[model samples]
Target: MRGSRVLSATFGYLGLTVAALFFLLPLLWIVVTSLKTPEQLFQYPPRWWPEHPTLENYTYLFSKMPFIRYSFNSLKVAGLSTIGSVVSCSLAAYAFARLRFAGRTALFYVLLATLMIPYQVTMIPVFILMRSLGWVDTYYPLIVPWFFGGAFGTFLLRQFFLTIPTELDDAAKIDGCSAFGIYRRIYLPLAGPALTALAIFVFMFQWNDLLTPVIYLSDPDKFTLTLGLAFFKGTVVTRWNLIMAGAVISAVPILIIYLAAQRYFVQGVALTGLKG
Candidate 1:
């Protein structure tokens, strides 16, 4: 029995290692490619390790483009969107989870139903509305909609809130606490993991979003990192090395944020659906 268990564990570890490598190898290649010179990048046999690694691509990327401005723009949009998503979604989730009201379940179901409709369906209409509001070629279109609570964020937080004991709400009420007071004092404080998870999700989404930015933002000054990266592609010759370098830079913040809040992210995901 011990021998069997040992063999099972070994296989499990082997499988996990293989899966990790499968995902990591491409990222490694991107980093390796970013360090290579243009000459080294287009070598005949394609060297895994550059014969001569250099930071020329990164230098060229910074010198030729307003990379810093793009970074700032991305930070602005993602940061504001994350804050908005957390505040709006948490409030909505608190209501759904704790408030007693007519049509609450039906309303929740209706919100979830919207998730089934793909963004592609509403993209054109939303753009038209933005254009009419004179928000085209601006950050408002990118950041403002997120201020309204999203279905996914609301649903995730609601599930997490449901897992918390209702007795706390009752106890808070007995202590002369109002609904908003209970949510602000007890629920929000205890929901650290869920809030962190939601913030990370919103930040990552807004940071990496390409389609929405592409549609709304036309001016180079307002371009996000993803949009800035797109400029590297030319009709005649695309700069793969520069693109890879920009990709590495863009990925750094996401990696840092995820690593920092990894514990909360895992805990939030694990606990969210426990009661639901």
Candidate 2:
């Protein structure tokens, strides 16, 4: 039994190591390629390390592309969207989890059903609406819709809310606190982990979003980082080094946010999953 347990542990470690390498290999390659010279980018068999490392690719990308502008646009849209999503989704989730409204359950289910519908199905109509509203080429299309509740965010927060004891609600009510007061004073404070997780998710989604921005934005100055990065891939030739450099830059914010909120993100996911 002891020998069998040791063998199982050895295999488990080996499998984890292999999986780690599998996931990290692409990231390693991206970093290495970002540091390589243009000539080294096309070398046969590919070198893991750059033969002649250079900062020229990053310099060229910044000088040539409106990367700073793109980064700012992305951050503005993502930051506002995250705030809107949190506020709207939390309100909706709180209602669904605590309040007793007529048709509440049915409405919640209907909202959930919308998640099953493909975004492609709604894309055209949404675009037309945006065009009609004269919001095309504006940040409104990307940031405004987030004010409305999202099904997934609402669901996640609602599940988290449900886990909170009703006794707290009762106690707050006895103190003459209204529904909004209870939500603000009692539950919201305790829901830190879930809110952080949702914020990170919303921020990442908005930051990485390409299709909505592409459809609405025609001007180069308003383009997000994802679109700006595409400038490196022209029809005739592609600047691999520049593209990799841009990709590395684009991934940095996400990495920093994940590292900062990783504990809460994991705990929130686990708590929500377990309760749900």
Candidate 3:
């Protein structure tokens, strides 16, 4: 039994190590290729380290492509969308968690059912809606839908708000607090972590999103980094170096934001997950 346990533990750790390598290998390749010159990019049987490292690929990448414009557009749209998601979701979450409106439970169930329906189903509707509003090819298509309150973010924050004690709500009410006042004073302050987590999620989703941006945005100047990478893949003979550089640039913001919010993200989900 002792020998069998030891073997199992060894294999488990080995499997984990293999999985880690599998995931990290692509990232490593991207970093390595991004640092190489064009001549070294497609060198037979790729080199682990650049033979002659250079930042020229990155320079050429931005120079040849409107990479800075694409990156700026992506950031602006994603940032606005994240703000909208956070505000709308937090307000709705507060309502669901604190108030007892007629058909509240049923409404929540319906909202959850929307999550069950794939985005593909609503894709056409969203497109038509954007077209009617004259928002196509503009940032509005990317930024505006977020204000309507997303299903997942609302549900996540609501669960967190529900886990909060009722006494806090009552205490605020005793101080002549209205519904909005209580939500603003009591719940909003304590619910920072969950809201931050949700904001992070919204930011990452929009930052890395390809489908919506690609479909709605026809102008090259308005392209998001996610869609712009496709252009890098097809443009030239020495594409790998530029492609890798562009990818790394795109991924860096997500890595930084996640690392910053990772602590709160865990607490929000861990605390809220138990409430259900």
Candidate 4:
């Protein structure tokens, strides 16, 4: 049994290491290529390192493009959206997890069903509805929708909330705490880990998103990093090195955010206790 356990552990480590390399190779290549001069970038067999490394690609990409403004737009949109999603989803989760109302279960299930359906199925209708509301070219179409709630975020939080002992709520009620006060005082504090997870999820999703930004935002000044990357491609050719540099820049923030909050993410999953 000891031999088998050790063997299984060894294989698991090997598999995970191999998987990590596979995932990281492309990112590593992008960074290396971004440092290579344009001439070295277009070489038939890609050089692992530039014969002469340069920051020309990143410098030129920023100079010729609105990269700073793009980052700003993405920050605003993603920050606001994340905050809104966390608040809205947590509140909704608390309601469904603790409170009872007519048709609550049915409505929650319907919302969950919406998650199974691809956003593409509702894309056109949503776009037309936004257009009708005069939101086509505005940040409203991007940031405001998240304030309603995300199905997955709410579901995760609800499962976590359900795991809490009911005694807390009963004790709070005995102290003359209103439902709203109980949610604010008792449930919200207890939900720290889960809320952190939801915040990270929302931020990463909105930050990396390209589709809605491209479809809704037209002005170059308002463009996110994803939309700004589009200008790198030409009718005749594209600046591969510069594009990769922009991509590296774009990916770094999300990487930093995840790394910083990784502990909370694990804690959140553990608190949910849903695996069984």
Top TM-score model: 2
lDDT of 1 by residue, 1-276 (tens): 999999999999999999999999999999999998878877889989997889988777788778888999999999999998999999999999989899999998998888889989999999999999999998998989888998888988888898899999889899999999999999999988788888888888899999999998888899999888876565216668878898898899989988888886676566545534
Candidate number that wins on lDDT, 2 or 3 = 2
Each prediction's TM-score versus the true structure:
0.92, 0.94, 0.91, 0.89
Is candidate 3 or 4 superior in TM-score? 3
Candidate with the greatest lDDT versus the true structure? 2
Tens digit of lDDT per residue, candidate 3, span 1-276?
A: 999999999999999999999999988988998999877876898799987789987887688778898889888988999989989999999988889999999998898889789889999998999899998888888889899997889998998898899998888788888999988888889988888888887888899899898789888788899988876576764677777888888888888877877887677567547755
Computed on alpha carbons, the lDDT of every model, listed in order, comes to: 0.88, 0.88, 0.86, 0.85
**Who is ahead in TM-score, 1 or 3?**
1
lDDT score of residue 100 within candidate 2? 99
lDDT minimum window of 10 residues, candidate 4: 230-239
lDDT for model 4, on a 0 to 1 scale?
0.85
Query: In candidate 2, what are the lDDT values of residues 71-113, reduced to their tens digit?
Result: 9999999999999999999999999999998999999999999
The reply for model 4, stretches above 4 Å from the true place, is 1-14, 234-236, 265-276
